[model samples]
Target: MASFSGFIRKSPDARLAVFLNAKGVHAPDDFNWQSEGRGTKLVNDINGLIAELPEGTQDRVKAELDHLASLATPQTMTAAEQVCTAQRIDLEGLQGIQDVLLMLAIDHPKTLERVAAQASLMQRTGGKNWSAFQFEDDGEPWALGDDIARAGFVTDAIALLNLPEHRKREADWYTSIRVHPITGEETEVLQATIYVEARAESELTFGPSEGLERQVFQRVLEVGIACNAKERIVEICANGGKKIRDQYASSFAKHFAPQSAPPVEAPRRDVLLNALLSNPSFPTEPADGIAKVQVSSLEFYSVGGGFARFEHLGDDETIYQFLERQFGAQSPIHSTGWTITGATLRIMQTPEDGTGLSVSDDNQCRFLTISGDRFNAAQHGRCC
Candidate 1:
């Protein structure tokens, strides 16, 4: 039986300990082969195991044990640097081989050494490119000799690709930047592609032409930013050039067409007049920043909707126009055809738009309301 304490300084020694442990040695702590008289037993055990193995396996195990003994020298702590002295291995490459060596120390020392040598070679030569590998004209992809050879090639290629310089070369050209207006957050967009296709036969005049035609189209993506208010998309580019258009019978037939419908227009005043006379209430104050006039009954309607707010300017003019000019004729303060009955007040054509006024019983003209087909008195209140 043997014990390992200081003797188990590195992976090779650890591998030896595992081997010894599996053999029912009962290896104890503070194990020193020479001082504790266990050295003879250990040697005898190793010899017995080797004698049982095949000749080739015996030789390999013996050689590896010898190598491990040599590696136990004091300076072996830095043995990796000594072994890879002139070889150029990137940190990643060095770490990869080191991991393999540690993992296989017990049974595959020779393989570990071979892999390390190959890794160093790749580090020096910057790895072999797959495209540069020669292939047989018989249609085979590549001739990498055997599975082990292919693995080595792939390992080297991975090391090279992990380098920052290699990655930059493979990165796409255009970088997209997107920012959220509300949060002021930015995001990077790696790639965006727009595919365009056309038909070959569509361009032919007489008989059946060729098959389908596809073309590569490239264009710039423009982004704009504005402040103080929200931004809106004004337009999008659709043309993929003339050759593409001709092949697709004057347009890209595969692309979806955007459908746009016209805005719904407000109902005409004449139609709304009857509804107003019956209900006699405004739906809502005109959209904020605009004023509207409404007449509940025929008497108010006869006065032409209580004279639109900015009437002195023209029949077609509105308060918005008056404010823009900043020099318009004063608006007349004539009766807005409003009449109060109990708590409810009725007025001519409801102002379709305005910074709505609040109404209460105590406030003068505060109970003001409007009646018109367009206005629903029940729905309208102080602007939300």
Candidate 2:
């Protein structure tokens, strides 16, 4: 038997070879440490050996293995092999560590181990809040909403959105709300928006592209219903629901031209509005009209050295519509080929609102009063 002290006395490579040989995995005469597939083979054989050992001995062996793995250079060990050896996650009989690594685009063993530890903690504590890991069916990687949230994993919305395989099939901007099974509280699983040229064109014709908003609202309603919070839902419908729906409808109608626009697959549903009206406790007559304007402003810069600012006095106009109106055919900005290099919309609301709408730290909107050409097209052999 290879004693722990004896193993420690050997060089790193020799330690690994001796450990494997002692565990009955005899090395062949031509067994070169640099051979292809050797790293994976070593990991698998070590994992198998650990599985057969007693728990205490397994821990001791894993500690020694981790020490040996730490000495591995890039030429000697792959990242996955190092992670498997160092972490001993295989002892838990869990899979999909590789998938998690691939999804996050993580290449270093230390980062992999750190994230894996967070995921393990999340799985232990998050209870039903954890979403079904989408990578593998049986062993779910902790990558989605509740898992990431509970783990306190520092990641952006875009990274979370791209983790699932069905990303391309979904709309660019949307929200996902998850209701806690026990607490019945609603949590925004993700609120992500990727503004691309195609998405912008589609939103310009139709309203905001129908995505997960309604579905998420419906989910909240269902949870409220289950909790016997009918009155709360009614209040939500009257206040938040009606306001959002009416705003969306107003924006859509203001921008949509019936004569030229293509037909939409389906109109946006007044989920919140319907919920308010359908409630038995609701008033028979129409509720008071929602206030028209909340006072918002838009500031933009042209590709050339031009700056413009506009205030939206009416609630019906979309930001796209506001931009189009400001930069329409007769406007000086229309002739300048104004390409939007960046944009941010900051919505300020009172803390009492509990809406939790705030701008991301990285995407904070800044007003640049004085500007220059964003890019020099002539330098790239193009006309400005």
Candidate 3:
């Protein structure tokens, strides 16, 4: 196969990727169905693209492409691995049934076929802590979750980054690609993750600090940015960027980069409070681009007086709900990125009424730390 370059050339915003990727190729809305004998649009179009590609290049990509296509099959574990290697499995001590199946597949298709085939006749074992299969052959322990505490954390990490919106993996693999907008340079991006699993407050606690809950999710996302941000930061500093190298970096983000430690932000807080209260946008979500959407939770501590106030709006509720449905549950149904499920509510100190939820009325309460659930785990923890 010969190499050829392709370009999307149009989209600057990553949000417009789908349209950009599919642009320039005109297939009949039904053309792929007619041409490829496939009823699916995505399938037919992909096949059409490969068909048009130079021959050798298609062969090179054929295996990789085929593997990706199988994830949609929604196959079950037991049937896919014909050999009932073990009835009980420990995912913690062991990786997972899927991991074992992966190593077996290279040598044992019979094992794979049997396991993949028997999707319906399956049973589960183990407590909420773990599960075992009733289809025990040879009493093997090819199970998973013996290390739910650790594996679950890693699994959660993979879920947050490699997959978007929680999609299943393909053939024991998760695939993703990043493309440079200007150069059309398609490159593989390796995903990184920071761990977050449901743990007791003691286990979850890190740093002798505040906002233990939000830190859980923040670490997960920082891993994503660290993949690219670290070198970028170093590059800027090495370039003799005076503002970051000498000014903000020393006082701001660098101080709090570590989860186990944080510097006192009293000085920064004083400076920040002036700008934030004046603009009230420094602490805005996105904290950068885009207009504020909806304020779900707000907690404020007045420096002049010791007090705390809390207010919550449901995910879809607007700030003006005082005029309407004010009594409905105000907490968030789900968190934004960390995927920690919880009812998000704002904590604020405001003029108290007998009917509202209780919060400190003293103004001296001063902002201890602004916090909320990143993963919405609060609701789960509460119900549990």
Candidate 4:
């Protein structure tokens, strides 16, 4: 009967081509109105279809088609909302809307244009914050207005929530996002959120929280106590510098405790600390620079696992004093200078091969310590 390509290009609804294709005139999925020169005869077919539209629908169809045509060339994107009023449609959200629409208009031009027009109308009347995609409708789109658009909203919502991604990271935390339809504002205005689930296949992670994640894992014991959370809380970073704490602090605190669990004296060696310090880098670095030690993201990925423990944090005065004094000018052959920072000590030490002395949780005894700039290990057979 009619060519599918011509039907899509000119008809307010591609029903003509759709009908023909459904009747085996053409493959239903093959029509792309975007391509040029489907056939000269298709124009006559499209004109006939337009006559069947409910009048002004053609204007919406024309505008959308023309806009789609312009995408063949570079188009300036002004990230704004067109807010004149009922007198004219607001173009404020055009960029974001156009991005999705352009993709949809490729093959499903008529359907997408109708949705775009409906969305435009919805945005115009819904509220100042309504979005093109999430239109507050008159319930018609739900009743044959646009099932495709309605379904997109559902899929779009799932993608926006990052549900699957969150499930993958094994998040110990979670926050929600509700997008304001018109203005496109995402809920959880807080810049970043760290979600840690105790037993999920995915995690909501970002990059900004790397440093914070490190801090969280390193002092998880203290945080667990402070926040009063019982679940296996983990830290995640979505991107560079997203404040995951403030975003989900109340929940995080609630996840731990409604009220902070009063500050407790940090134990001699917290469990996490004990485990991490056992690693080579922890007990031997400058305490000042220790806070900024760079660890691989790999370590962050493993998180709370034995292998990823970082040793480049915290201060232990006794340990510092011992290393400083014992080694003194007569420390290990490779003397590692350490700085004392409150409770955390940073030291530099050569990797030990279990030779001179063995230090463990039980035998962390106190003793007089020596201090000096350099040490000759061969002469003094004293323990370091």
Collision count for each candidate, in order: 22, 0, 44, 57
Model 3 lDDT per residue over 1-384, tens place: 211111111111221222213332234444323323323444545556666756666665454333322321333432332224331222233233434443334345444443432332222111121111111123322212233333443444344344454433221211123333223344432222232322223235445565453233322221111111211121011111233223322322222232222222111100122121111322444423322222343333332333333344343444435323543343222122111111222333322342332233222112223232112223111211
TM-score of 2: 0.18
Winner on TM-score between 3 and 4 is 3
Ranking by TM-score: 1, 3, 2, 4
Which predicted model would earn the best TM-score?
A: 1
For all predicted structures, in order, the TM-scores are 0.19, 0.18, 0.18, 0.17
Which candidate ranks first by lDDT, i.e. highest? 2
Model 4 segments beyond 4 Å from truth?
Answer: 1-37, 74-102, 105-384
Backbone clashes in model 1: 22
Residue lDDT tens for model 4, 1-384: 222333244433343344333323442264444344545655555445555655566555555445554432221121112111211333344334334344345544444433333333222322332211111222221111234432332333233334453432211111222233223444331111122232323334444745423222211110110111121222222221223223322233232223343222211210122222222253335533322221111111111222211122223434334444555653221223322111222222222343332233113222211222111222112223
**Can you write out model 1's per-residue Cα lDDT over 1-384, one digit (the tens) per residue?**
122222333234444556545433334576443433444555564466557766666666556545444443323323233233322222243223223244446344543353333333222221121001111133222222234433443333223223332221111112223343223344432211122222222242232345555444432221110011111111111233323213221111112111212112122111222232222434565443223233312222212333222212123433335433554342121234332111123232323352344322122122233333122333233210
Better model by TM-score: candidate 1 vs candidate 4: 1
Clashes of 4: 57
